[model samples]
Target chain A: MVDIISQGINLPLPLLMLLLGGLTSLMVGLLSERIGVAKLREVWMIIVSAATLTSIYYLNQSVQKAGVLVISIWGQLPPLGGCFEIDTLSIFMSGSIAVLGFLVALYSISYMEKESRLTEFYTLMTFMMAGMTGVVMAGDMFTLFVFWELMGLSSYVLVAFLKSKWGPIEAGFKYLVMSATAGAFLILSMAIIYGMTGTLNFAAIADNLRGAAVSPWIIALFSTLVVGFGVKSAIVPLHTWLPDAHPEAPSPISALLSGIVIETGLYALARVLFLTFDPGMFKLPIAFLAVLTMTLANVMALLQTDIKRLLAYSSIAQVGYMLIGLAAGTTYGFMALFLHIFNHSMMKGMAFLASGSIVHETGTRDISSLRGIGKMMPVTSLSLFIALLGLGGVPGTNGFISKYHLFSAAFGSGLGWLGIMGVLNSALSMAYYIRIMQVLLGSPKEGFKANEAPILMLTVTMAMAAIIVILGIWPAPLINFATSASQSLVEGLSTYIGAVLG
Target chain B: MVPLEPFLVSVGLMFVIGLYSLMVKRDMVRILIGVEILFNSANLCFIALSTQVPGFVDPYAHSIVMMAIVLDGTVIAVGLAMVMNVYKHYKTIDIRKLRRLKW
Candidate 1:
């Protein structure tokens, strides 16, 4: 048994994490087809949950033990051969993906019970998990592209999963067209990189571009990648698809889209910009984008009537706050970005889950119709209150702590205006957050009786809400993790070049 | 020997045109075709870039182009399925007509 275990398991930690989870989900997904489709919900639930959880464990352990793990296939040469370099930045990202994926999958068990075709839903979600893992861990641009498409394809299917509704189908179509076009821009940019540097591996291109003089093509490359990734992350001017798709999809998947998917896309943008290009030239554009994204999203969110759509806009604004940290381009900037990513995932995930409970009970997500919902279901409303407090950056919530770090990074890096604008955006966000709380706590409308959400959903929602406060009060551990992850990214590029070309 | 520069320019134009259509075309089918055009342009760019290495074609570029085509095909197929659904539900594919959701 020992010999078998040692010999058969030489795969690197992060890729192995994605593969085991992905392959297991694919296998279970296929099996569920021949078996009674809806008969084995528990089986699908156990398999996916275990897969995501186990992968999160191994990836976390490996990053803790070894700072960065690079795995290449078939002894092929790099800057060309497909490769995976799992560092702290990628670990932090993949960990966030898997952690939220596990929680959402847990919530899905109770939430998706009334819906049919449960097997396929879990399968596609797992494939999406695998796709995201592949993207962040990719060592070369092409690998990232390949996995990006995988994630895109899976998400389109998910967005349209409620195919019986015209709204879902329409939202899915718009999302597909926009996302696919963005993908083309990414490929074009990659071709430009290859045309100049003749390598797809990130480290080699960084070294090549670093030694070269500034050129017009390089600038175009930056803009195209930004546009390509910005759409997925729901940056302003390209965020029109989010409100429609998020509101139309099932709630757990809404959590997945809002909580993890958009951020992963932003991670690619930050990774490419931070590691592969001149950070100085890109800083201003990113800062401009940050300011634009926050202000516009806040304004739109203030006028929203639907619940999920409101959360979707709020998600875009959070990305803006993270982008401010990115524009600062310091280790502290990166720290702020990562810390806020973790915190927002908790707060927003809980927010969507709680609202989903409301929608589930009431069958309507319109803000006007849901007045006084808190009077009927205290637990769910309490969860929503906690979520709102976190989003509003109340003193004792995780959102405030992360936003504090982000503002400090902005000011410390001489972008005091950006930090101040960020504070203003947070203040603007308060108007809508308070509106939601008011509606939840208002007088109970006659003829509306909503039972409490299922135990499984309530537990998941409460768990995320509690984690927000706990992390806010004692934020040292998550902040330390974010600090270490950012430190690795700032310091790891040269070490990355040495390892790749050694 | 063929001039790759003109070919690259043409393909670049093709991509820009497709992007324009994707942005402005209200008809769903036209947008899907625009996506196809962009994919073909990207494929052309990949093939053109491979000409730099003399005497042998770059296998990696070939494989990537092939994979992109397949993914592109999947996207188009999905888009078509969506169009069919739209036609069934609303009897037309004009983008403006499906305005129930506030954009």
Candidate 2:
């Protein structure tokens, strides 16, 4: 069984594909440059990301059959050395990453064709996806941190890729400073965990530390963990960089960052908090942060003039909503959480891509200046309208389906007030979504001219829009997958530990 | 056994110093240095905690610290590159001067 899984692949299949693809693409990039071949790197990226998706499908089959597949690095067993433990949850999360990456790679071909530095852009983007994949599949704290840094490093460069402008440079620096600080706190948290448990493995740490009585060390660990993960996730107080950074990055990257990258941070937070403490222990504090995150980000999002920045703030507010599921701390709640993660990735990712098409055509991100864009670019504007409605949780959209499940899960867990706050915030967020919609649908301003976006970008946005609508209507399959994913994390604890310890 | 109090106190002090510099420093390069200090403080905490075990030091913490230091160096390298770009654009490394992107 082991040999079958390991045949010609030492690491997890998705991670190996991504890492190898990222490395070889660097060479491909240089060769393309020397050979005067254009669009070669873009083609390589598209194949790599698509292959990553296929590998995840294969890995998912193995995970389902084995229940948990533990792959130790350097031939060292777990609880002592670094490893990757893939359960249903890892497959689900990495599947989301690869899906978004594949779509973004396709969209970037048309979107970034005019930009220079194609090599660095495609390579760093691939590494960034590879990093997120490793992070989700990581079995130990050190492995997670290493991949976390890899993700962080690649994103910092990608955020700053267009250095000809001051906006990206400044945003990238601020992002780097804050994220590097978070990385430091993550190390400190690891040290404290080691001090408490004498091992860095997730299963070992969970074995030793979960349900331990409240102590100063536990309190310190909790705060450090929050600080470490919160900045990247853009939890309210640590979120200043996001509004700037997300908008300043190139549009496709903006889509990826606001779409899945922040959710990856929230995913790490959920995984660690669940492993180290009982759900009852951290529920209230996380709940409180959820309220703060939602209220503040919604209010800020309402005030934004720039379309992408507004979407960035809305992303934070969505993170706030995801935290409600975490705070509820039920299997049902976790299912809701992961459900919302996938749904939001599609909705927000499409929203950004659609807006990116708008920006590419009109050369502006200001919402007012985009008046009558719907008239000029009917297909792009139509997709954007669908994306906006999905994000606002309108009925018959996937966002509403996941959000309905999320709020009910909160109420089911006796967090009725949180559910109420979530509903109110959902209502409040619609104001901005409608604002964008109105801008798109309004009569055209004089002298405004834009043709429909290129066929590739339009197809990607329309595909995501179709997904949002189709899943909204027939959500049973996705809901079932999310339920299994959450069950692995919340109820399959024993199986996960046994896979690691034995 | 070696006492852990002094090492813990030093780590705490370094942390505070690093955060203070991060908050107060105007120079972008100094801010990056502050981040490096914070990283080193965490590395020191790991090393110190690894020593608390009697009769033998855990090699795991040493290995992690080695990897972490390299990671920190790369992060700072990226930060310095960003700082250079900031200088080219704003003609100053003062972070406050790069405030064209306010809310």
Candidate 3:
């Protein structure tokens, strides 16, 4: 079955499903319109995402057997043409994307029911997921760039989806200009890489350029690459657009954007950075960036009165935490990084979804106005409480477990100072989390009213909360999966290059 | 092989000009054009580098540039759409005026 598709570009099963699903969404929208069926686009979205998850399972099994599955394109293999090189790491990242996408699709059905242009919404959402899937699995730089832009374009439109609003329009334009500039940096980085190694395939580039002596050009390449991927990931100094874009976007998109999209950018940065230079070479700079991102975002989050905007700032803080693992640059550090990515997806995704439900019912994002609404929306508030606790790294939550590993990984790698700073920031972040909790559980203002979110939204948030707790207490399976995933990147370099060169 | 210095120098100059326009220009459309200029400089770098390959120009870089051009165009298109929306709301394309959302 895979052989037949080798005639063109060989995409992993899940990516192919998403891309095909995105393309057909418009036709399905028309068909549903003609048939006058309600929720047809919503149902299609759920099915496509569910199918994507299942395909990732199958692909994982094959990757376990094959070590690295390189599906060539147009009869041209890697080091020459674009292809997909699926290993455990790709499988893990794509799996996280699919899981969050499926959850968000379900949540969107209820959250966006009243919004017009359902067709375009679902189509763009699907393409966004497809683009992310393609990015993690891309064997070559050009393919990654293509998918990266697809993700960026879809997101820019989605951020401005509520076109009637001045807020979304202004924020979307700012995001577009900033991100488009980053795209140019990406192209420049590619040219630099191509100039250095005369190839863009990941395996080939790694083989040719890894551990080369540092030159002035290499430093230039490093800065360009950082600027390129940094904007999307919301690294400090490039993070101005994020606090706007995340809050302006629809809640489900906020969930996806904050949940996995930024992580996808970090994933690319980790992959390329690891492939190009030794961990020691990048350890100090990334560690410095980690400190800056965490400290600044947490401080800013403390001041946001808007609920979603606070969450957006908190997302940047979480990115800072994840960078500790990257700075550690060990296999263990990578494992912790991947684990945090998944856990944070569940935690942050649920937080946004729950907050979205609150906003949907209450029609306000101002925290002061939301006082004592927890009693009215008991289930959503409870789930959100769990999510907030997880984000704050409270015990018996997956966030705690991952944060423990992340900090310990920093310490273990002889970066005790980074670990200390991380611990302080974790404590600092809890201030805002507690503020939100107090608002939710505090006494209600006069005439304040909000019933619980609809059954679908409640169920999704509750299920995510349950996973957060379940994995927190018993995280062995996920830890093992993360270990293998990181190993595929950190320790599997020889096999990675061999798949192409041997 | 073609000389690499001249091409590199021009790429550097174009990059600085692009950044200058992006920073100094307040018009939304001009900012989009600035992004286009930045993209073109990178594409030209690829084309120039492709020429320096020993005996034949690498078609691979050319192919990547072709796709990159389309990608940038689509990005600019989206930016322009958003600019239209911005104009509708604020009745001005000056970026400084669109600063309602802030800390």
Top candidate, metric DockQ: 2
**In model 1, which runs have C-alpha deviations exceeding 4 angstroms?**
A1-39, B54-56
What local lDDT does model 2 show for residue A309?
A: 93
Q: Candidate 2 residues A1-502, lDDT tens each? A: 2221322326898998999999999999999999989888899999999999998999898888888898877677777878898989999999999999999999999999998888889999999999999999999999999999999999999999999999999999999999999999999999999999999999998889998999999999999999999999999999999999999999999999999999999999999999999999999999999999999999999999999999999999999999999999999999999999999999999999999999999899999999889999999999999999999999999999999999999999999999999999999999999999999889997887888999999999999999999999999999999999999999998888777765
Off by over 4 Å in 3: A1-9
TM for every model, in the order presented, reads 0.95, 0.99, 0.99
lDDT score, candidate 3, position B64: 96
Candidates ranked by lDDT: 3, 2, 1
Q: Weakest 10 consecutive residues, lDDT, candidate 2 chain A?
A: A1-10
* Evaluation by DockQ, superior candidate among 1 and 2: 2
Give the lowest summed-lDDT range of ten residues in model 3 chain A.
Answer: A1-10
Give the Å error, residue A74, model 2.
0.8
For A225-245, candidate 3 gives per-residue lDDT tens digits of: 999999999999899999999
Q: What DockQ class does candidate 3 belong to?
A: high
